[model samples]
Target: MDEYVQLLADLTEAGALGEEWRGAFERAPRSAFIPDTVWAPDDDAPTGYERVTKADAPDAWWSLVNTDGVVVTQVDDGRADGPGIATSSASMPSLVATMLRHLDVRDGHKVLDVGTGTGWTSALLCGRLGDDRVTTVEVDPAIAAEAALRLAAAGFAPERVVGDGLAGWSCAAPYDRIHSTAAVRRVPSAWIEQTRPGGIIVTPWGTPYANAGLLHLMVGRPGEPSHGRFVANVSFMWMRAQRPHAVVEPVGVSDHRGPSAMDPELALEDVNAAFAIGLRVPGVRYEHVWDDADPSGTYRMQLSDGAGSWASVRHTAWDAEDAVHQSGARRLWDEITSARLWWLEEGKPDLHRFGVTIALDGAQSVWLDDSGNPVA
Candidate 1:
């Protein structure tokens, strides 16, 4: 069997791929959607990826494409000589399958696919639900055009629009389901307005502190709240409008310094802890930077509220109490420690146990176990 087939087999064995969607996935092989020239990770480059064209490295390119890993299709939104940060990509096949499974699509159901990167997802939707039922919206014109061509070439043509996915496509309103490939900090009210009551809206949702967890919200009637729990851990590029600021070195003098009893690992390494802490500490972004200059292994876990507030906790290999420093308006370290305590007091629930409710006015609240018990 070929690599693509092997990937499907692997996903099936891993329970990521459901038998109901197997045919759709088979029709939409990832290799067919991946571009000839894509980006691969490079340590030396300032941008995470260096370009790799199929012409120059066919074997490597094919290997990368057929694997279950993500294929970066565009960089810096396809700007000329722009930074190499990935702006669009064909997500991991396993993740794609998992999202589809969570979507719970049925016969005659209509789907609005957001962030049509390579159009692989649109193709799969079209194959399963028919071309007339799938409408995909993409923000980048060039990326959308390329995806259109690929979708046509693959013999699947869904209605494709080049526009911000946050607004969604209102012309085809009251969809049965809406799925997003990108991550969002907030669930747009338009999505709720466009989806029929009892419809499912699956997307990667998170705060600035965490790029994401896969959310599967069940839409309520118009003017009512939509609620859902996080089903899985996922990391996707933020929606262009919701993208957080890049981590930069903290400026200004330290406002306060003291010893911190909390371990930096909870914030940096524990995904569940980070997700819960993020709900408590909104607008916070963090970076764990290693001190390569030091002979002894040490790192600084820094947190910034993206306003004037910032904090840093220096950690050594010996597990000694770290020194915490805070500057500007908010004592971010103190807030995080308190949030961590809250998380621990609540039994440190996993991400799956967390849910969110979006009111009609677009106000969002995170909760544990149920929507009635909002996270404080």
Candidate 2:
């Protein structure tokens, strides 16, 4: 009657835990892989979390672990003093199960698991196919060591490679399947190179403009470009190298000007619109901002990129005449609004309707209906 046991039962009833993956789920219960100290979302805060550890708060830690939400294990490469950027985490069970189901691996298939976070996925692979058929790679040396020790303690041992996952473990090339636990802005050609023809690759696809989803690609011949359709809408932290490296000089918000005819309210409600916008616009980052000056607590969609471009669309309500201001070389808000409008005109394709084709140059072209025409 332990809470974790009850959680397994609940996940099973809900169909999140497949029969094939159940044994792995039971044997490697996420609780075993997670660290004693973890960070969980703070209910009272908008974008903050409270740390819970077995030493100081065992009850809270257990409660949060079994509650089915992401647990931040390391923040800011383990250097941040407080709840900062979550560099590593024990992903929720449902999400893990979703990815595994999409992976569609079978017995005797050699799987290369990218992003050895907590080693839970590797352990699951071990439980199903045995340790011999699984190979895992971690980008962070410290994380690799910790995960290796955890996997060993859990009575599973897979080929552990301490190297950049983006390059892939070429030593074990021609893997029957590949699964990446990280969000990638660009599909790495090395991954396609390493995967065998007819093999499947499952990874999270991220856009710089603030949207992400699951990309399930079925590999063709070695020289053929890897292509696949997005299967789900989900968010993940960016891959290490894909993160912002260069610093952009600061900008005063007062410099931008103009009232936009485009309705800000229309942009905020459509998740599909946001995804389409990100597809058309590259390297753009956006956030929902609020100022106390507005009594209505209206949120402004703020957009910017490394090109010194910035735009903000504020509205007290969606149908109201919202104010928009833009500055710099690129007009981000105009690009986003135009993209959103185009999506509407095209009948609004969902995630599944969209697919990506990775050229030999490693450039990814996202298209709708088919790969004939790339999205703007």
Candidate 3:
């Protein structure tokens, strides 16, 4: 069987591809949107990616395009001197299907597809809801131009715009559904403002500590807060403007040293704990450092606010309690520990139990179970 057929079968078995989107997926084959040159993950490579071209390795290129994994199409924002960080990509097929499923679009419903990327998603939306009803936007001019060309080649042409996706396309204001391929640290007010009452806005939302979860928000009447819960766990590249600040390692003298009763593993082990901690403790980035030379599973969980505050909790196999060291004005370890304890007190609610409310003024309030019970 062909790669496309196999992909469809796998998605069907995995329940990621819904019947409503089956026809659209078939019509919009992923390979058509993928560029001839793509980047594949390689630990040995400088940027964790090694470039592969269709001319050099046709089979590898085809395999990458057909699989459920993401294909890195552009890196370093298409700059020559910039470090090779992934700036744009064709997201995983399963994830695309899942996002579309959450979008819950229907006939006559208009959609604004953010982060056009390779334009595969825009093509699918056009296939499902007609080209006229779909509008796609990309921040990078080069990516947008390439996507427009590919969309036309694939016989799908939705309204394409070259601009920041955070500012939703307002010319076609008040869409029935707004689907974002990129993740955001904060749900843009423009998205909420452009979505009509009772419409849906599905985007990946998360904190700097976590890349994120799929947010499915239902638009309320004007002046009311748009509310929604995280329906799925997803990690997409952050929207360019909203990407997290570069992680800075903790440096300099330690201000406080003490033994903490909490295990460092608790924060990283559970998704619920991580999500809750991320929501409770904002602007903190986390990393786990391990010593491969040691056989024991010993590591340190480091937290930094990227300002001056930093903390480290040493988890040793010999100790029941981890040793905590903190410096700079704020004690990040303390904040994280407090957040973890709060999560436990709340019965360790599943990540889905967490919800967010976006007010007309764009102020966001995260809650557990109900909107009245804020995460704070």
Alpha-carbon local distance difference test for all models: 0.88, 0.82, 0.89
Q: Give per-model TM-scores.
A: 0.94, 0.91, 0.93
Ranking 1 against 3 by TM-score, winner: 1
- Candidate 2 segments exceeding 4 Å error: 43-47, 244-256, 292-299, 317-322
Which pairs clash in model 2? 265-318
lDDT (10s digit) by residue, model 3, range 1-376: 2998999999999999989999999999999999999999899987788999999999999989988898999888888667778888998999999999999998999999999999999999999999999999999998899898999999998999999999999999879999998899889999998999999999999998876689999998966889999999988889989877765665566568788767777777677788989998889988777689962555788788878888877877323343777888988888988999998899988789988999888999989999999988
Candidate 3 local lDDT, residue 372: 94
Q: How accurate is candidate 2 locally (lDDT)?
A: 0.82
Q: Which is the leading candidate under TM-score? A: 1
Instruction: Give the alpha carbon lDDT tens digit for every residue of 1-376 in model 1.
Output: 2988989999999999988989998888888888999999998988878788999999989988989898888888888588777888989989999999999999999999999999999999998999999999999888899999999999998999999999999999879999999999999989989999999999999999876699999998766788999999999999999998765656657568778867777665588888888999889888878767873465788888778888888776324444787888889988988998999899989999999998878888889998878988
- Residue 188 in model 3: lDDT: 95
Q: After superposition, how far is residue 353 of candidate 1 from its true place, in Å?
A: 0.9
Q: Rank by lDDT, descending? A: 3, 1, 2
